[model samples]
Target: MPSYDSWPSPTWKKIIEEQLEQVEQMPRADFDIMLKKQLPMAVYNKELMTGDTLDAYLEPHAGSLGKASFFSHQVAHYNAKYTESYGTDLPKLKVPVQILWGEEDEWQPLMYAKRLVQDIPHACLHVIPKAGHFVMEDEPGQCSDYIDRFCNKHP
Candidate 1:
């Protein structure tokens, strides 16, 4: 059900291979260049945040994000462990489970959420409208409400 239940498709494989090469070379980052790339994709609604907010979000993580070698190592480890149990690793989970996702997620599309719901037993999915990868930032009140409801159900 999950996209990575098997090896990545050729397109992804190519991207991964290219990223591996880039990470190995450990290229020096130009933040100005990177920010241009990051800002456009990071959020669906740029207007929701002030320029200062975006800076605050990106600045602290800039160092970690720049650490290509470390990033590559983690990716390699996860790639090695990829399996059919990828998304449903906790199938027999005893606790309550609810999967909340952004309906308009640019990277992870609707199919991913649908597959996740099918794979995880008893996991209900909530797709927040007009939301992207950053659901909390996109719909804070609704996200909080979902969290609160999940907590209440479990407790």
Candidate 2:
């Protein structure tokens, strides 16, 4: 029964350590540098500021948002739905589709890219280095390049 914030903290660490007997892995220095470079562009400053202010406003009235639930539910639902929808016969899309995925994405592994290319008739796959699930956010330039290439080829 760990809360969202606490799940990533001491309780989860102890459980993981006990069950998996795994040591915490520190981020590589280059990864930190890449994160610093990417975070600004990833965050919509105005939206972030607005969301923060709204959170502060709502903090005083905790009951306003209604019943609290496991934060992971939404993510689980989306993942399940995505898998279900894509499991069917692939769409007959004529437009050129580019599947850009991060090599380091834990949520959707690079194998998904290959599966996508196989499923989609005109799909091309691009794997971005040193990126995670949020590939567009992590590698904006690479994402833009993929889009540009797709457009050029399609046109």
Candidate 3:
């Protein structure tokens, strides 16, 4: 998962600001109402923490951390090994897949959701409106309802 601060586009920042403002200005009840209006069938991740306070939490590690370099090297190493070792004969996966994507997600994009559904034999796709990469945070009720329906249908 990419850090919220790592978003490469200004539009994403604007969206984040709007979401933060929504969270800040509204009481819990009103926030719930707003979410329902935005996305009618999403699940909430109650553990999520947002707003400017999170920026303060991440501030200490913002500079010269070498974290980006480390991850790049790790990814390159895995890419080389995986290509040489498995090629096209990687083991087939049989897990049933349910992809719930936020239409407004700046990080992953909706195309990836479409690709997942296409590539997986038994995959279902649910797209939530007015939501970003953090689907639960952006449209909690919709996410939750989608998960419930997927589970019931599959089971």
Specify the poorest-scoring 10-residue window by lDDT in model 1. 1-10
Q: Is candidate 1 or candidate 2 better by lDDT?
A: 1
Tens digit of per-residue lDDT, candidate 3, span 1-155: 22222332353355355564444444545544443343322223323433453334334424334233322343223223433343233124477778888887765667757755775567778888877777877777888998898888879
lDDT of 1 by residue, 1-155 (tens): 12544344343456467775564455446534444454545356767544776766656435645455345554455442465545557666656778878887665677878876776789899999978767788888999999999998888
Q: lDDT of each prediction vs. the true structure? A: 0.63, 0.50, 0.52
lDDT string for model 2 (63-152, tens) is: 412112111232123223345554455557777777877777654556667777787797778888877656665678888988987888
RMSD of 1: 3.9
Q: With candidate 1 superimposed using the best TM-score fit, by how many Å does residue 41's alpha carbon deviate from the native? A: 2.2
Residue 122 deviation, candidate 1, in Å?
1.6
TM, every model: 0.71, 0.50, 0.47
Instruction: Please give the ranking of all candidate structures by TM-score, highest first, separated by commas.
Output: 1, 2, 3
How far residue 69's Cα lies from its native spot in candidate 2, in Å, is: 9.4
Going through the candidates in order, what is the number of backbone clashes in each? 0, 0, 12
Best model per TM-score: 1
Between candidates 1 and 3, the TM-score winner = 1
* Candidate with the larger TM-score of 2 and 3: 2
